[model samples]
Target: MSMENAIFLQKNVGFCNALKRICIEGFEYSTLYKRIEKMIADEEKKEEKNEKLLVDLWECNLLLSYQLDSKMLSICVPCLLKFALKKEEDEETPKEVEMALLSLSNIKFYRAEKELYLNEIKEIIRNHQEHHNLTRLAYQSAWQFLMNRSLVYRDLKGIVMNELHFAREVGKELEEFAKCVDWKKEKEEEMGKETKEKLVLMRWFHVLFIFFGLCNLWNEEFIGLVGGIAWVLRAAKENHKKISEKYIYLLGNAAKRRDVKVEGLLKIGVVDSVLEEIQQSTLNEGVTFQSCHFFLKISERLKEKTDNDELEEGNRKATKMEIFEKLEEEGYDDTITSYHEFLHLLKVNKIDFDAISLDISEYFVNV
Candidate 1:
């Protein structure tokens, strides 16, 4: 069937219902699986030129990815990875590489046990990192794969941290972009025009790094994770609002982690940034929402920290009073009071916390 027909059926009857009718009522998995298998076999034949057929097979795999179960998805992984890892010869386009990576990322989501293929996926990611420019799609896909893995599999924390370090290195250009006196003005300059283009590419890289860091918020003990947060805070202080929002969301996730130390974040000026954003009268709604969210979490964390005997007596009292004084001095107390009213309005309108995250989709794209 054509893409148009498939889309029409999906829109009219719904995706899952259309899929069920096509797969269950029309063509069964056994038959479709055989057809996919034959297509893969033909693609592997040295004597044949079956690129079009292979592209069609990948498109089907992408569609199946929407609802395939673990077993069915597992059956398709090898073929998908084979296509994903294939050398880009004269005829290959970047879209093919992107599709393959997207399919692998999708299939990896449903598999119950990820251990069996984690190393292979890591290797693919490393390959992309080494040849970064040639494999932008692969690089993005690989980071996304690691992000998903980190969220679902706790044991992969060490690996995820290491990859985040790699991501920071990959995103060094963002550091340069951060240093620009004004990115908006820079974009109008001749030399800065090229930097602007690269900045667009770096957007996803920044989002992925922040997301990966968010997933590891529970592992605050890791020195790399702590250092990463500090780096993000520094960047947040200097970068444009577009980039700063990502850093704010990262801080919010870290603050919300029950195991994280409030003092450590306080020492790094996370509290100051949140307060600064909250105090800005011209702040946009998305930034204001994240600022409010981070403020609420910090308050909760501070209260919990104060109640516990983890800190030395003198230090605890001083730190707690300092934070409270800062809030009152900056009028954050009134902001919180107004935030409560805002949140009550949200509740009355049936807006949930998850919906708030979706409202700020630019910062938290895939999360």
Candidate 2:
């Protein structure tokens, strides 16, 4: 047989052998584990056939199967992490590294012991951003690994927020995503598949940020960042209903934060975007509620900022007046009426409609 045919036959034989082993009555998972360990360790000596064998295992679901025992996951995770973190002289990311990241992503089960490798994965995320060696898919895989773990491991949430500095990193990424797609051009003209994909990624980032924000990971520092509330609101100008609704929801959540700087909201024409959402002909009840609440909360925040003596009196007065004017221009009374209507429809007892009206009127009083 020719060399190419010989290698193909050998690969098929190995796959068949693995399947046979899995079906055997006395098969021990440890046997499969040891085989994988050996293959990974002797990859160079085996002329890289081991990488192909690993890929076959993954494709056969032998490695990627979530039904596998938790013990098996614990074993595979460390092995995969070590392989992914291996140093190499090549400038390009090796296929081995990509495969390892892919496999790690599939191994979804997490344990306290896995916390040891969290820092290592964080390194991969950072290095990939700095060096551009890992493909985008691989880099995203690394993030998936962390996000999955963070969900199951509560301790990792704070680590991901404070240690990873996700606010800054996610902000930078969203900014880069914005640059890749001309939202104005897409709205006015036609978009290619790649641009569409970028928009999808943009939504994914927004969703991810919202998730973290609800987890109490976001803070005041986010206002001025590249991917902050203002940056997200910019998408509201486009007629993408899903994006508009989601960003408005996020804005409402941010408005509730006492620490968040209300000036950031007025400076970015946030009221205009909120008005655009409120006036959507097809706006849903949920979005309408959020938009009205956003106005109420911003007014409250402006009052808080004005009351605080830390800010310069002139700047505070100017900002508070500017926001009140925008609110009046955008029909704040009409929004409050809508909010009360929603309260009645939803039977929401947590909010005091009268108090909300009073708080909003406080802003207009000072103005």
Instruction: Tell me, by lDDT, which candidate is best.
Output: 2
Residue 356 in candidate 2, Cα distance off native in Å: 22
The worst-scoring run of ten residues by lDDT in candidate 1 lies at: 358-367
Reference-based TM-score, model 1: 0.59
Q: How does each model score on TM-score?
A: 0.59, 0.62
Model 1 Cα lDDT, one tens digit per residue, 21-107: 232332325565456656656675758666556545654544453455566555455555656666665556555666566545443
Model 2 is weakest, by summed lDDT over 10 consecutive residues, at: 358-367
Clashes of each: 0, 0
lDDT of 2 by residue, 120-189 (tens): 8988877876776675445655766677676677677666666666666666655565455566767666
